[model samples]
Target: MRLFNTNTARAGVAVIRAGSLDRSDELDVPVHAWVKRKQPWLVLPKDAEMFEDASTMEVLFKLFAR
Candidate 1:
């Protein structure tokens, strides 16, 4: 999955379980590191609204709407 910070125009990719949205440290480290480095004010692995892979357009709409 892809995560984007609209405020900073920065984005990262991560692998999360579809059912639980759990992230794997080994796979997500790079994304975590980038977030820590570039957007330290933000906390990771926080509770967030989850969408299915098919809801990508909805995600994009919501993101841009904000």
Candidate 2:
């Protein structure tokens, strides 16, 4: 079971953020992937690397970037 915080719960009030839709177009596929690849550094807990970080958002961006 994935645990989420109050912010996460509040943020998901709808399928998307109420005013965030335009951000997607600002992302070039390359930049998007790069940002995603590096994102895990922000979200993963320091001691949570039990297995591959492959499924982490950071890895996804890295894969998408290349």
Query: All candidates' lDDT scores?
Result: 0.40, 0.37
> Residues 1-66, candidate 2, lDDT per residue (tens digit)?
322223352343222322355565464332221233464545443443323322344543454578
Candidate achieving the largest lDDT: 1
Candidate No. with top TM-score: 1
Question: How many clashes show up per model?
Answer: 0, 1
The TM-score values for the models, in the order shown, are 0.24, 0.20
Error of 1 at 44 (Å): 4.0
Q: Write the per-residue lDDT of candidate 1 for residues 1-66, one digit (tens) a residue.
A: 443223323244233443354553344321222232445575566444433223354454555576
Q: How close is candidate 2 to the true structure, as a TM-score?
A: 0.20
Q: TM-score for candidate 1, please give it.
A: 0.24
